[model samples]
Target chain A: MEKILPIGEYIEKGINSLEQNLSFLWSAIDDGISWLVENMNDLFLAIPFVIILALIAFIAYYVKAGNKMFTLSGLKKAYGLTIFVILGLLLIYAMGYWEEAIQTTTLVIVSTIIALILGIPFGIWSAKSNTADTVIRPILDFMQTMPAFVYLIPAIFFFSVGNTPGVIATVIFSLPPSVRLTNLGIRNVPGDVIEAGRAFGANENQILYKIQLPLAMPTILAGINQVILLALSMVVIASMVGAKGLGSIVYQGIQQNDIAKGFESGLGIVVLAMILDRITQSIGSKK
Target chain B: MADDNNIRIKVEDLTLIFGKRKKEALELLNQGYSKTDILKKTKCTVGVNKASFEIKKGEIFVIMGLSGSGKSTLIRCLNRLNDPTDGRVYFKEHDITRDSNKQLLDTRRTEMSMVFQKFGLLPHRTILENAAFGLEIRGEPKEQRDEKGMKALKTVGLEGYEDQYPAELSGGMQQRVGLARALANDTDVLLMDEAFSALDPLIKSDMQDELLQIQNKLHKTIVFITHDLDEAMKVGDRIAIMKDGVVEQIGTAEEILTDPATEYVEAFVEKVDRKTIITAETLMFDNPIIVRFKKDGPKAAIRKMREAGVNVLPVEDNDEKFLGYVWLEDMLKLEKEKAKTVESALNTEVPSVYKHYTVEEMLPLITGHHHPLAVVDDEGKLEGIITQTSLIIESTRFDDKEMDKLIGEANEL
Candidate 1:
């Protein structure tokens, strides 16, 4: 009889070796990630609901208005978008999922911000050099296609199952789109425009900041939007590993077979996703 | 060596090769491999090959060639926009090719500015902001940059369009903004790479005239690139014709028209409207037989006319001023009437055209007058003479048959 390969066992053993050897590194990352998530979650929860709504409305208005001056016409131009954000946030509060919604929002914002900060440089590096591109491209592809549940396993092994692991898994899961799109946006800056920049004696840094970055902003924002959406989608999956959010409420309802709670929590996550999506879309659409 | 003070830029043996195997390409190039062969063996594209030239200060030196002839690449090399694979570029005393990044940027900010074929105006920027781009890049203060930008915009006739975005403007307006941007840079040298080629023909001509007007006032040393020979001839004080990454010829419009250096150059010059391009100086015979009134008698003049086999002889005064001409018939009549002096034979009612007058401008004088025209300098000194025969010979020198052959050959180029 043909022998079946024991690939799963080998992976488990290899992971065991890594955990045994890299315990200090793993604990350091775990501690830092925990400290960050706890503080962000606490900060988000501490903010009054009214203030959060005002902040979201302000962001919505700012993006929709385009010009920074808040004239009557500008406010009128932005009112539709602001109203949608207000209604979505108020609905989450009315359903008694305000705290869970805030926790999820905190998770999405924290992971996405960290991921983008890391992703953009990787993107620029990948765009600028062929070696970085060759090395980073397939690694990004692997990170993207690997199951989110699979990220949780190694993440749990390292950080040991909580919001820390949940945030880490979410970050890993959502990072590829940001990196890929930023790379694409920068690479897509017109060759003639880059030549024009160089011809005008702009240095590499100046060209990147003044020419490439401004022109690539829309695409980069689109990438950030993708990262946010991916992060939100991971919240429910993350709750299985003891992360508290609207995802935990949904998970609790599912486990208890309470359809009404499940539906309400599910609706809350959708509302948050819609509001974030529209605001980011508005930002990305600006010239 | 004596023209060193006037030389704004000099490029020596500049060569550029693209691809990963540039070393191999260079080796093959040194061994005399053709560009195609080098490309085949090393996967490299040769951009410019051994291009060398000098642009004098305040002169519009145009580099012209069809696409892929490396004219654009050679111009870029002058500013080190494309770091040449091998060789040096000298902008006045500074060896720009050897300059550090900071020094190069400094030179670009201060001494050189470029206008691009695509207009290269930032879409996100307003027209005024686009015009201010160069000054902004130089870290100039906002108030000063905007003031300078506004002045440049006014120069380009784009005054009211300052706050408008680039997209809101037309193509010609965008190019005007591009010109404004270059002007606002306040550089001594302007490198315009097909700056007007993207515009329609009418707009291109207008821009070309506007550029000449600007040059007349500002006297900025401009290195203009174009595929259109007409544009080159119109604007260039001296034009460098390029082919296959090499400079084929460099000369003024008349010099290129009268004496093309190669078959390719001859073909390029063949298509030029000689009536517009060839001036009276080009068509004039510099050493026409003349009888100086103080030096020669009527007999000597008749003898000279008979020996030279011409019906008309231009009569110059003792000061070599073009007094007029003496017709053979008139001279013979004077001789028969015992007129001792050639002055009696001289017809002072001679048609005169300035040496700088284009043949097209001299056509009316040529058609209305029976006598050959004398080409005189500003002082009315006899520079040369232009007869109808000379005009026809110079204008139709490229016969239809020869032109067909040149057109056939130009197609290959």
Candidate 2:
């Protein structure tokens, strides 16, 4: 009877664990879907920014090509300038809704900066040491594949809700790509180039600065671009934890059934996105 | 100790093995396994094997081999770019292999500069900035760096294009920018690994000429690596031909051409035209008659020729020396009323070309002229004679049939 009771208790504990896990997963999905729906308007706002920036860069490229200048002219210059103008316009528009947009931008920017600072070093370390790569890679995979809202609950429990928690959640969401790309870039730098630099009497720092980094710039920039876009995507979802900005505006639009407001904010967000994308692309092309 | 004209680099028995299990691979290779079999068995590769050479100050030494012959690997090993597994390399008697990383860095930054096959120009920097990079890294002031960089750019003939990016330039121009970058460092030693191989033939020739010009002026001790024999002949003071990670021969162009030490060396020089390689200096006879002619005379020429103890005499009509002939033959024929002109009696005439004419150019003339051709100075005075006998003796020594016959006779014994 005693052994049977122990077996019964074990079964009960297993059932309890299963139920808890299932409930946690369900809540995570529910939160993610609702957050995405609420932020649809902010996503729309970011779209125009993206378009405007891309258009500017394209114009700059065209102008440069038309003038027969090897450097930027014609459409290329126009494209770059247009992108800059659109970004400026987005910032100005955000000023009207200043406090909220500023809060969201700050959350996004701080998280991105943290992610970059932490991610790049970690990535380079992993690339340099095989043991570190093996250890960190699985963790990176988990961070990347886990649901965004699932991160918020744990992040909230650790740091609690508000800007800090929001920033933490965004960092967790945006950090993986930066790490992966940094590793890939550093590792992909041609072996001969490194040797050539060494033969030229380049020390470790010189090799990294002159040979590896310059050669790896395109890949590193690409990673940063990915992180930026990912951070922007996470902004509105972060609003659930008291983060503000165009995200809050979108959330209010949804709650009140104000379609016009939703569309306007969505258009603004698009413009911001376009601007970021174009500038990054230009930097990449130049490198 | 720091004289500009001393041996700059000496490498002895340099060997580089890649992968941790190189010994096992080498053992397998020794056991009559193919490269693939060895690789499968031990997963190691040998890059350079016991290579040895020396680079004299101000001399352009070329190391030439086909791909995988270890020429590139050997050059890399010189700067410790790829550390040799065995052997010692000395730079002016300092053992570079034992130098600390800081010392190596200092040596590389100030004493030696390298140019890569791919150019390896930093794409993000302008040509000027790229050229100035080493100076920048060494903490030189921007103004000084810029001045030096501009000077380098001018040296490479890209004076006006300093602001342009590497991508904006053609391949040849990009390579020039690379050259400028190396030159800007003002290093004592320059190592070039197939620097001109990537360019078009015409551009390659131009670059070779440019390199020769630079070497002549700077007197930089250079170790250049190439696969092209013609380029090696043109630029190298001495050439080391490598095969299967071993040097087949190392000597001056004339030595290699005149006396290849090994069958492999002979095979390498076999297809090259010899005439273009042998100079008049190699072909000239030791002694010849010197004569002065006051006028065009058959009798006075005979007297001068007898006094000089030679059949032929050069006819100097003022300061200018004309063709030589047998004065006795001319006088006797004239005395017998059967005389032809001195020009008709002269066996051969040699035209004065530049002093560097190779053996290949002289061979055909020696064969076709039917008599020894006179070697002449730029002033048209006869230097000496380049005879067919000397050419044949120099050439047939490397003939395979002679070697095979000697071996056959030895085997019979």
> How many residue-pair clashes does candidate 1 contain?
0
Instruction: Estimate the lDDT of model 2.
Output: 0.74
Best by lDDT: 1
Interface RMSD of each: 1.0, 1.7
Q: Name the TM-score of candidate 1.
A: 0.90
Each model's fnat?
0.59, 0.64
Q: What is the C-alpha RMSD of each candidate to the true structure, in Å?
A: 5.0, 9.2
Q: Which candidate is the best by DockQ?
A: 1
**A1-287 in candidate 2: lDDT tens per residue?**
44645875685677567556676764564455335434643554556555644555455455334444455444455555555655556564654653455445555666778799999999888877899999999999988888888767655654446555576778888999888998899899877667756766677777877778777878988898888888888877787776667776777788889997777666656656665666566566653
Question: lDDT tens digits, residues B264-379, model 1?
Answer: 99998888987888888767888888998778777788899899898888888878898988888887888788877887667787689897888788877767567888988888
TM-score of the second chain, each candidate in turn, equals 0.92, 0.77
lDDT of 1 at A262: 99
Error of 1 at B215 (Å): 2.1
For the predicted complex of model 1, DockQ is 0.61
